[model samples]
Target: MTPPATPTSQGRPDKPALTVLYDGACPLCRREIGVYRRLDALAPGATVCYADISDAAVPVPPGATRDHLLARFHVQDRDGVLLSGAQAFLALWRHLPGWRWLALLGRVPGAVWVMERSYRLFLRVRPRLQRWAARLD
Candidate 1:
C-alpha cells in the first residue's frame, strides 16, 4: 500500500515537511530515529518525513550508500539543506524544546570532536550489535 501524503503548512502537498533519511537495518540507528519520531509526534506544527533507505526503492545520493548511512544519521531540513553525523543530530535537537541545549554543546571546545569520535565508535560496533540483536530475535 502507498503511504499517506505528507501535509504542508501552506497547503502545498508538493514539498516535504522535513526529510529524515535513515538506515533501517542498524538497530542503533533505528533506536535513535525512534526517539526523534516520538518527539516529533509530541511537538505541535511538526511535519516530519521519515524514510528508511534499506528499501530498494530508495535512491541514495552521490558519495552516499547504505554503509555511509549506517555510519551516521542523515537529515534534510525544511529548506533542503543536508546534514549528517553530529551536525544532523544537532539539527534535530534544535527542533525539540528541552534538547536545544544539546545544540549549544555542539559549539563548545572539543565537543564536536568528541561527538564525531563517539559516532565513529558506534559505527565500528554496530555490525556486531546487529548480529546480537538478530540472535535475540
Candidate 2:
C-alpha cells in the first residue's frame, strides 16, 4: 500500500505522521505517554499521534496482533516503518520538543543495545508494577 503523502514540519507535504501504540493500562506507560502528548500539543507541526494498545478493540495495522503489541512498544513512522522496543521510544522522542537530542544520542553506537537491555529488565518487573498501578488507580 502506498503511504499517504503528508506535510512535514518543514512544510514539505510528503512526510507521514508518526503513530505510536502504547499500553494505557500500564501506569508507567500512561505517565510517559501523557508527557509526550503534552509535548505534542506544543508542537502541532510535528504531527505525532498515539493509540492505546491496552484496549482490545483498538485497531492496529495488519500483521500486528494483540500479543505482539503487548510484548513491546510499537511506533509506526511516517514512512510506515514499524519500530518496537527501544526503537519505538526513539521514534517518539524524535518528535517531542526537548527530546530530539536524546533520540539522536540513541542512534550512537551501542546506545540502542543498552536501552533494549534496560527495556528487557523493565519488562521483567512490569507485571508487578501493573498490579501496583491497578491498586493505585
Most accurate candidate by TM-score: 2
lDDT over C-alpha atoms for residue 8 of model 2 = 60
- Mark the regions of model 1 whose C-alpha exceeds 4 Å error after superposition: 1-5, 14-17
Candidate 2's residue-wise lDDT over 1-137, tens digit each?
12345656687867446887888878878987889999988995657777787888777767778778877888888777788999989888888898889999796999999999999999999898878877877
Q: What is the per-residue lDDT of model 1 for residues 41-129, given as tens digits with 9 covering 90 to 100? A: 78887666677877768766556666676466787765567688788887778876577798999989999889988987887887888
Cα lDDT over the full model 1: 0.73
lDDT of each: 0.73, 0.81
Model 1 lDDT, residue 58, Cα: 75
Clashing pairs in 1: none
Scanning candidate 2 in windows of ten residues, the lowest lDDT window is: 1-10
- Worst 10-residue lDDT window, candidate 1: 1-10
